[model samples]
Target: MSRHLRLALVQAPAESFEQFADGLRLRMKSPNRAELVVYPELHLCSRGAEAMTLEEYYDTYAEPLDGPRGAALGALARELGVWLIPGTVLERAEDGKVHNTAVVYGPDGELVAHYRKIFTWRPYEPLCVGREFVVFDLPGTARIGLSVCYDAWYPEVTRHLAWMGAELVVNLVQTSTSGRAQEIPVNTANAIVNQIWVASVNGASPTAQGRSLLVDPEGHVQVAAVGTEDTTLLAVVDLDRVAAARKHGTGGDSWPWDHFAPDDTPLELPLYGGRIDPVTWRPAVSPWTPEALRPAVPAPVPTAPCPAAGAAGEETAR
Candidate 1:
């Protein structure tokens, strides 16, 4: 039995929330209906260039997950009757720190999962790092993992998700004009190495190269946009293919995880777990605190005193 998921990658540039909504409606209304639709990273703030200062930009664009914009997106998802990964946005959490957050809405208009980008393309872009890699079941489809932009660069991000039973990885990207050259290959490699499907969507602006892509488990480019143009690319992802690919191995002698010895390995990295306060959205205990499972460092061996020097001299002489 072939389990197929029809997905659409939206590559349109929006200058305002209205424009974004319109673009989404246009894609949704397409004759070919998609079961899932993905948008680019920072789609809500694509007009930030018009702001005078960084603070001004964030202030004008950043919104809470349940804010008016988020509500509108949820409503749209319900209206279209499609699972929507509406790309990333500047999420102003209750902690007062802004995060590059990707949100997923199910067809019933509920926020299913929220993933913060662990790797903030730093020095180049100033953004707070996210602490969690979120994965969720897609009901009738495969398990899904969420990443944004630079997160795809780290092989561990996808591997961790795959290890946790994710069959498809969606990366929402906002790359600089010169970045597409690098972004495409890295994401392609991620899909191949992890033996999972990858759907990457980038903003269709001059600043962003716009080349959204969908790579199969075998690292084949199933759908890709040509240039910076307002367009949507559609493709059918087969979970059956993912299973078949994993069975064949990742084009290597052994699975990547097989290379590591499991003995004495910590069950979980303390850095990766936290308890967030539901109301405040802040961590009850910081993830940065050292974990108890960390292996203790062995003390340095005691050295012989003057005898060592004498012994060395005797050895040399002999």
Candidate 2:
């Protein structure tokens, strides 16, 4: 079987949830429909809230996963009979903190998976950081990973997702700044390094700089949405390509994932002050496991003073 999934990336313009929902209903009325549809970050949030304080706006919409808005989104997906990723919504956690979280709804209106933004564009973004990496199965088609706007900028996030066996990493973005120019390259870079498919979807004009792109496992941009215009990019991605890329080597050259042998010397990482045993390494631990939930960054380890050195070390210490 061709494990190809047809997708529609909705690069809609600045609009409220109601407007987007209505448009989605109309779009699904057509015969040509994508099996899965994705929107940009914060697509359903009230753009009118832009006038309000960020805190006010986030608090106003923040709700749990089973909130009315979430149920409505799930119903929309079921009614349309398509897998839907309606960008992200502000999730009100049990601890009363608000998080920018991405959600997926299946064709059955079932909530598939939710991943809170890990790297929340810190120093500017007030949302709390999420600790775990999330990947979900698309049943027979593929296993997918979720990340928000700023998460793609960190290679560790995507690398971990790939380690968790994600064939496609969906990076939903909403950048209204010039920094988007750099995101494009990083999107491709992530795909190249991981040998996985990447769909970096950004919003359209007035709200974002829409230079969304879909990259193949070999880092080739298959469909790049031009300009900051409201548009829909349709493509059929074969999950098999990801397997083929990893198996045959990326562009038939490097095979990073399988390069190390069991008997090979463990490569030492000075920053971590240890080497990962190639035979015993397990990078993708289940996020839900209590023992697996280590601090996002490990605590600093105390080390003994360096051995007495020559003039160079003396100068460094001074």
Candidate 3:
């Protein structure tokens, strides 16, 4: 099977729900239409939240997974015959807790997967954190994983996803322009170290610079949006690069999977255990069981031989 996937990244301001839908419609109509369309984090609620209080934003924008916004996104995916990741929505789950949720719709417009933001950006954002990492199969294509905004800062998030057999990892971001220089490099490094494709989409607001980008397994930036402009970046990602990268290490050394232990038994470090006062340093109980730590199935091995050095290059469609 061909391991190529054409993807479209939508980088635009979420001024209103209507504007978001319109922008998405326009992008989908492009001559370089893609099999997958991705949007920025908090794409539907961020702009509106700027004008209202936190409580008001929650009351106004937070809805269930089956609400109007999710329905509209599903309809759009069905209409375009594209797999869609419509960014992270502010969801009020049945548990009555509000979460920053990312939803995936299959080409047939069915909800296939959803992931809540595990590491919420702190200080002001009020959202319930997610416990588990999500990686799902994309039928005949490749397994994909999702992270949102600050989650990319934690290497464990991407590493766990890769360990779980994700060839491509998507990150939806909503952050200030000042942080772009820092954010891009870190995410690019995540791609290189994890040996997976990293597609990051950022919201286009005055506060947020829309430098959406795609980084290949080799850590090369395939495509990036210009400045804070509203634009769509389209690229053809070769999933085969992932296996090649894992087999051949970055910097001329063989990739060192033999020494790495992802499932090492838990051990308490003395510095953490002995330094901090037990009363003040209470750790939250983890929700993941031993079964959850293991991959549902082993990652599919690539049958093809590695490409010649420097043969893998960015395939961008403006």
Candidate 4:
């Protein structure tokens, strides 16, 4: 199935949820026969949480997965006969917990897949992070993985998704000036590792410069937007390229396999012994290091209760 699908990426100013949606609707008047339309992270809410208080923002802007914002996007997708990846939204789940969620709408105005942000930004730890990585099969030989803003920084997450047979990884990023450089490496590394396409949608303002891009499976920048102005990016991607890249060794002369392997033992060292600051006696550098660079190992997985407790009551009853 060697067919091409057109994907549109919107890079607009960080406006209020309602205004942003209205602007998008106006801009997307008649898409150029595109198969999908993608948006940037927190497309509804501004980043930094500077404009509004948490309580006020949540009450005023938060939507359920099937709420008005979602419904409208879904309807748009159906109207256009396309897939719509409406970045991540601050939404209230049935559990009453707030999550940063990405919802996919199919051409029929039905909810295709709903994925929440797995890696919550440091400032918003109070919000519950999503535990699962979602990859869904599309109608016409397309497989996609969805990610939120900060999630792109974690290469392991993208690597695993690539391993799970994702042909494309879509990221909705809220790129601040400080962390903009990191985005390229993160997305490109995934393409290099998994040999899949990456589509990134970024915000356009100086505070949030849009560096929207589409990278090939071989980590080549197929198309990228300028950071100067607000714009929408449109591109046609061939799924066959992803499959070919996976087989052709990413067109690289060399690959660093030694880097991805698990270490034999945890690296730890004493803090101090003979240091320059003798009175304080604190080591300038400690040998202690994490199993991986992204984060320390998570706590051990919990085990289920043993079956003996269930049988113990049966014997007494008999």
Ranking of all candidate structures by their lDDT, best first: 2, 3, 1, 4
Alpha carbon lDDT at 275, candidate 1: 30
Please write out the lDDT profile of model 3 over residues 65-157, one tens digit for every residue.
Answer: 898878887887898898988888889999889999999998887889999999998866779999999987777667889999899999879
Using TM-score, give the best candidate's number: 2
lDDT of each: 0.76, 0.83, 0.78, 0.71
C-alpha root-mean-square deviation, each candidate: 10.0, 8.1, 13.0, 16.3
| Stretches of candidate 3 exceeding 4 Å from the true structure | 260-318
Candidate 1 local accuracy as lDDT?
0.76
Clashes of each: 0, 0, 0, 0
Residue 263 of model 4 has an lDDT of 23
Write one digit per residue (lDDT tens) for candidate 2, span 124-147.
Answer: 778888999999977777788998
Residues 1-318, candidate 1, lDDT per residue (tens digit)? 556889888887755878777767877777556998888888777675555577887888788999998898899889888899888888999998888899999888988889888999888667788888788877656788899888888887987787666778899988865878888999999888777889889888664778889998778899999888978888888876665554445553434433333232334446658432223211111122123311223233344355677788999999
How close is every model to the real structure, measured as TM-score? 0.78, 0.86, 0.80, 0.74
Identify the runs in model 2 with alpha carbons over 4 angstroms from their true place. Answer: 272-275, 280-318
Q: On residues 125-231, what C-alpha lDDT tens digit does candidate 4 reach at each position?
A: 45778899888767555778888778888875776566565778898887766676778778877677666789888888853777888998788888898673788
Model 4, runs deviating above 4 Å: 15-33, 47-49, 252-318
Stretches > 4 Å off in candidate 1: 250-318
